[model samples]
Target: MTSSRQQYIERYAEYAMEQMRRYGIPASITLAQGIIESADGRSPLANSANNHFGVKGTYNGNYVLADDDKPNEKFKKYDNVGQSYEDHSKVLMAQRYQQYVRKLSHDDYKGWAAGIKKGGYASDSNYVSTLVDVIEGAKLQRFDKMVIQQMNAEGKQFGVQSNPLSNNKGTKAKATGMNLPQSSYSMPVQRREFMLITSPYGQREDPINKGKTQIHHGIDIKTNKDNVLATENNGVVVGVDHRTTTGGGKTVTVEYAREDGTKTRVQYMHLSEISVKKGDTVNAGQKLGVSGNTGTRTTGEHLHFGVINVSADNKLQWVNPAAYLAEISQKGNLNIEAQHNGKNILAEYMTAGTKAVNTDEQTPENWMSKLLGSEDAALGIEGGGDKGLLGNLMQMFMTLLMLTIQMENKSKEEKMQAVSDAVINRHIDISSFVPNLKSAVLSINDKGNAVLVVNDGKKEYSHELTNAEKNSISNILQSDSDDTTKRQRIGCIVNAITFSYQASNNYEQIEAQQQSQQQTIQRR
Candidate 1:
């Protein structure tokens, strides 16, 4: 078995790399996804059906029941591995992945992979890392050489076409790889909280000295007139230091550990003043200290809110706090109206700025509203409002759903929890799926999970769920994450998902890419 696995893996490395070049996916990721999904091409799905990618039938269309993808779970079958490769490439080139395409232009694979996961291209969380592993292990540099030769021989010796299918694996060098099995999740965390934007995280002067010689490790967040730096959660004050900062200057570190073992360290860097001391336990609303322009940081007075992952070595791993600070919702996502120049303009998040949304005629405000309820337009749905009365009371109900955005405004930390949950909970607004959503959130538990009391605008749904159903939800939400790479995909199609990939306006992303690359090299 092991020998056979090795044989197929070697074949996959050669095959996937060529496919990546043709499809524009990173060869490394393509190799990795094959290893993980097809079990080194030994699984029944790959062995029998030749459907090595294990794509599924979706709500929109296209499905086939194959051998390995669970009893009822549909999988895409192919005539042979060649066809499978072609399908994979075509899927990636779909309109849903425009941002993915742009990422490729910059050769930023990490950004592209993270963009895939963050864009909900896949429910898998470690989608990026998985790809990274495959790329490295396969030593895919070997595969890149074979590409031009194959292309040169096309129609004569290669007998290949000028254009490959969008999802064709041989075309995408990066799809070479791309997380978790299953889980018994607690109730889905649903949140509705007030959010105020003071300043963005990691905004600073040039981190790198002219793109060479020196690199900035992080961005700075300016604090508005308030001297208060609030907590992301209720925990203990960890440190107050005045020296030894590569970028943060004087810093105040607050470690917030929930009732569960989920510990998050919020570091307020370059603060001029520190009000809290070490070992002092604080609440979520407690003021930690005033923001400042201290240390080696040259930016004006700003609060640097940094999310640090505590390594087992007790070292701090800095992560982007925008994900931890803003109450940005996921999935059913944000119910937002972009107010620009006194007029309402639809906008979408972009790598540079929020670009004007150019969408089809069947948008929510136009057509989709009539097909499904905003509250029930996704997986594990909850219909809002009284069914018969919804039409009669459309004006009143719509007014209230719209009004909730303004009615309850809260701190940044609270918004963080709310948006995090909303993002994880599919395509429903926190408020629309659950009434009293602000109060429904009991607390986030360990393992980054939370329980919620969800009410679809009218009545709360039954809280009871079997272990199997609960596991399904858990598997979907906390699947493996993607790795950070320089060769990225944007607006590329994957499965049926089309997405817009983005990176930091600041250079924090560049640092992140370098850091992750170093880690990958170390593992090798």
Candidate 2:
């Protein structure tokens, strides 16, 4: 079946909203220009060159010969639709469009459109009216509303107070039977099944020095994985200490804001590697580093996790890591299994004073294949489906097409072209939906047929599966460890769909891009 105009808008709405957040461009203006300039995403230039908005001249030493007002004129080409969209945003910041940037708010689509035309973006007499018709008729202004809501929820403006952990404070500390600490709370490392708490946070015999008892301010957690994860939400990396001394070595301290707007610091120490530097923003569950015995005081590979709260009068108090993790663990959700390195690994949430063992899966790779296979069965193609490739690619074209629509202005277009030259030429693969996937669910429909629902945050797309597909998905979900949450199960199904689809349609392109990216890093 042929793609619809509405499908184009829906597919790229998230990307447009993200651009709006990053570049202060109205989502409405971005979407409107995309529709009109790309002929609802069916333009030849868009299809062959990934050049939306008919941007002219040499872009990064790459040029596509296309007929515009004259034959064989130069037009800007992009590697992906996302790059085009980003370039469009940058183009609008040029000298000619600087007035619009200064005068218009990010949400004012009308002002942007008027400013673009008055600023001589296009030679066509009806450019302004055409853009207005597209914006108004499609209710693209609603996207602007979505952008604002997302930003407000994130508390990025207006001095509005925010709490990142409001939804994550799972259970009360008393319920876990571990005496709660006076101030501050969180798990040092999440999914405790893979981690063993070797040392508790209290007075104990020093493992490093023989005999004498010492007051330990931190808990020691041992894990097989080299990487470490953040414990609290809305955290900013405040300090990084790399000294190899008596204290824990290679530490990263993150400052977190509490409900009352006060701040506390969580420290992860004894690391083999660190992923964050000072002044970098971090989120809870973000990978920070690998566990290692880096300090003179440490005996083996383990995480020395600690928390500190400061009073208004400059007093300091240490919080018990063991009790804090136990309390938070009692209220936390079950762990989800994520696919990494072709393995199905589950991050297990631990209860107070309990230890967990690995599941009975003989091999993780075999399990990953079983779960991912279900996705292929549902799509009704081979193990890797081809039925959806054409459609996916077409939609990708439309997406890229809209991204460059705002680049028609002469002065900014030239500037964008120059910048594109500085960055190496690359291409976007439109045949895979892996980048947008959030979660998916597979279940029996009213008619008893297996159906799959894929969520990309903004909307859900559903497809019916074959009988074989239903059985495969059900079996995979049921076979996972008991610690896996329902959300994790759904996530498994969604990832399986994406992995299989991309493998079948765009595997080579994906591999090439990865290789190219690696080379780019090597060059740098």
* Number of the predicted model whose lDDT against the real structure is largest: 2
Candidate 1 per-residue lDDT, tens place, 1-524, comes to: 35665676645554564455556565555656677778888787777667677766532243466444356677765544766765766666666764545445323455556755654667777777876665566564434434443445544222133332222122111111100011111101111221222233221224434432211223343233335544433467878786636567777777755333445566767676677888887754466665566777444554555565453444343443433331222212343322211112222222123333344332222322331233221212124334311332332222222233323575433433333233223222333223223322222222222233343243443223234533443343234432111001110111011111122212566888899999999999
Least accurate 10 contiguous residues by lDDT in model 2:
161-170
For residues 173-243, write the lDDT of model 2, one tens digit per residue: 34322232344223455542223345555445677677655546777764433468776566799988877
Candidate 1, superposed: residue stretches over 4 Å from native? 1-208, 212-219, 244-246, 311-319, 326-524
Quantify all predictions' global Cα lDDT against the true fold: 0.43, 0.55
Q: What is the lDDT of residue 333 in candidate 1?
A: 33
Each prediction's total of clashing residue pairs, residues at least 3 apart in sequence or on different chains, is: 96, 9
